[model samples]
Target chain A: MDLTDRPDLAYDVFAKACPSRGTLEHVTGRWGALTLGALAEGSLRFNELRRRVEGVSEKMLSQTLHALERDGLVHREAQPTNPPRVDYELTPLGHEVAGRLLTLIHFLEGRMDEVLGARERYDTARGGR
Target chain B: MDLTDRPDLAYDVFAKACPSRGTLEHVTGRWGALTLGALAEGSLRFNELRRRVEGVSEKMLSQTLHALERDGLVHREAQPTNPPRVDYELTPLGHEVAGRLLTLIHFLEGRMDEVLGARERYDTARGGR
Candidate 1:
């Protein structure tokens, strides 16, 4: 069974000590950026998602999706066909968050040059100071 | 000495495997959230930042600033006046990052209701499923 299709985790952003932090970790997790990027385009099967998001382990992908699904950001629909097909999409709220995340990603990619420069200065000053 | 003023850590976001991730941890770290939030308003002294962020421990705040400074996302200047006065501000790159972060924060705050609703459904369905 694809763990992404399971619904068990619950995220609470309001509470100070809620699972919200963990949920944030999952949503912004390393794979999360890629997963959300793919979902923003459209729903995809587990394997399809895996391809779109490179460098993700099957276990991490499954765990990330479970966490996102638990937060009600991503929706997981399982089709009961002979082989049991599953697809994932963003919920309305997920779309909002995805929009912001995409902005961050695009911004990061756009500013890669500046970030590179900053890294150099940071490294030099760090060594001296 | 305020750990925030020290320049030792270095962040490299480009490298697939570098201290970048941990630096990201510091910049986006839990307190990193508040630190950036405060710095966005304007350069602030460490104590002032501590007051504005609310509920942040001295250790976490210091660590967060140290990380941000290493990444060149924050500029720390120590004034050698009567008492050692230090102020922190966002570097140009930091300002860019902080802008996007603000967007995310505002978006999250605005969608709190929807996110809360999603949380409820997630919890209920999770219990049953």
Candidate 2:
């Protein structure tokens, strides 16, 4: 079964104490969204992920990857060499979330014109904030 | 057309300069996610939204709703009266994005057990961080 298609489990995101909130934060974080989207295309070396994610600091990149890895949404593999080679890929679960996230990003990107128009109207109505 | 089903729009979220990045940030923010999800069921009053989204401060909730409204993802209707009641609901575009986001949240919440297990394994291997 695809990791993203779990139908038998449930929790209320609205609950203050639900563990799902932390997971949501990790899955939908600013960098987290981009990282998963990029990786959804395929696995990449550390530098490749950093490059694809654009403007992500090395520290932030590693932290994001580490958190995803810890949550089982991402898998990190190390190849022993003169210098260790590390590669990151989505687990089946990661792909599921990434696919949906990519769709949302695409949708938002497509609607930029509308969003910008609304922003202009809002600002105008508010007499410029 | 269902706003969530846009196939003709595209943008590289990987690029740092994409305006969609800003939109994505607003849509997927911590409080933003819960707010959108709550509003998806139906239009809600300010206090109703506050109650459903638990753990959100009044300032943060208002800020999130304003951003969502500005982005054209949500509709805010004010019934001028003694107290001027305001109700929030998803726009077509908002419904599309919120639908996907809610799915992801459901997915993540469903898999909390896996995430916790993974975290335990990760910590064990790291000798406890």
Candidate 3:
């Protein structure tokens, strides 16, 4: 079914066949999470963002950024200059989502200690120690 | 590098090359998200859970539950009964994480309207209209 057909219908992430799943995959992707977190600090050029987020291939970086850009979560600014310069920043909606995303990151950080301890206990219990 | 070696080191989801990325993938898998959301309500038998979560095959459900169980996030209880009956519930740790997971689901639900509107606006802007 076309989600667009139901313009009045609200989008639920939990829906089995919702296209939002693709959006979630894009936003929560390996590079996407890092990109979002990096951009959360402020806007950055494509190269700058690539450098800030370690272990990302140029192709993946460009692709992720494009996906985010297409979704309207990211705004891309291009400057006509020598060698070209571009910047990426969050949209208003992006800012709100990023705020919640940061909340998830913070929540994970707060529980890191406990999760680590549990991992150790788990390893020992499973005879992996 | 072995994350197990650094037992004291906390796991960050954003950290590059971190094993926790694997955990996140498992918990946030296509099936994983659905499984967690389904189990949030209460414990369920394996068959029951599989049925409750639509569009999931037996293989994926088994794999996702196994991963959760291994990570100490889910407690699997097998009852010695005819034809074998099993129940799955969140551990104390699982309860904490699942609470946050539910919060995410709820947050998405509340913002479903704005997201749909954004999607429509995005489609129009992108000439997908």
Candidate 4:
């Protein structure tokens, strides 16, 4: 079903047939999360996205942007310039989604200490790490 | 570097060598996300987890749990009884991370129309769906 056109519909992630499942994958994939987090502050070009996301290959970055764009979370603009300037900016929906992902990421980063402790204890319990 | 012992140690997700990057993958992988989301509400058995997570195979469900457990996000309890009973529950840290993932998931599920619209437009721009 054309879900994008109808913003009022609800899609459950738990359901195997839900299209949102695919959308979630696209949004939260390794590079996708980083891409949105990087764009949260402002727009960036293809090369700029590559640099900001750090360690992402050009092929993956391009793929991530294409998926995000297809999901309506990001907008791609091409400008007439010597090098054909292209920049990606978050759409309203993109901004909202990125903010949520960023919140999760920040929480994970902040709680690294707890995570470390858990891992340490976990490892030590099994056998010395 | 025993990062788990020193929670204060900074692990950049952007850096290739950082462990948090791998942790991120484990926590947000296709099965991982759903598994965490499932446990956030309450505890579940192996069969229940397999059910709640939709199409996850037994091998994948166990693998996801194992990774999450290694990361200190899930706790497996073994109950001695006539039948060996095992249940999985979220750790405190797991609770926090799962909440964050849930928020992002809810947002995606709520925005089905926007995603569907993007796909529809995307598909139509290429040719009718």
Among all candidates shown, the one with the greatest TM-score? 4
How accurate locally is residue B13 in candidate 4, as Cα lDDT from 0 to 100?
72
What is candidate 4's TM-score against the reference?
Answer: 0.90
Instruction: Estimate, for each residue in A12-118, the C-alpha lDDT of model 2 and write its tens digit.
Output: 77988877888888889989999999999899999999889999999999899999999889999898876889889999888988988887787777778888888
Question: How far off is residue A13 in model 4, in Å?
Answer: 0.4
Screening candidate 2 with a backbone cut-off below 3 angstroms (N, C-alpha, C), the clashing residue pairs are none
What's the iRMSD of model 4?
A: 1.2
Residue lDDT tens for model 2, B46-70: 9999999999999999999999988
Global lDDT scores for all candidate models: 0.70, 0.87, 0.73, 0.88
TM-score of 1: 0.74
**Model 3 agreement with the true structure over B12-101: per-residue lDDT tens digits:** 665677656666665566776667777887999898888777668899889889778777677889989998889998778777667766
Off by over 4 Å in 4: A1-9, B1-9
TM-score of each: 0.74, 0.90, 0.79, 0.90
Residue B51 of candidate 2: its Cα lDDT?
96
Sorting all predicted structures by TM-score, with the top scorer first, yields: 4, 2, 3, 1
Q: Per-residue lDDT tens digits of candidate 3, residues A60-129?
A: 9999988787666788899898988898999886776677666665665556565566667767888985
lDDT of 1 by residue, A1-129 (tens): 563364222322323454444445455566665677679989999999887776577998998888788777899999999899999999888888889877766665555456556667877866954
The top-ranked prediction according to DockQ is 4
Clashing pairs in 3: none
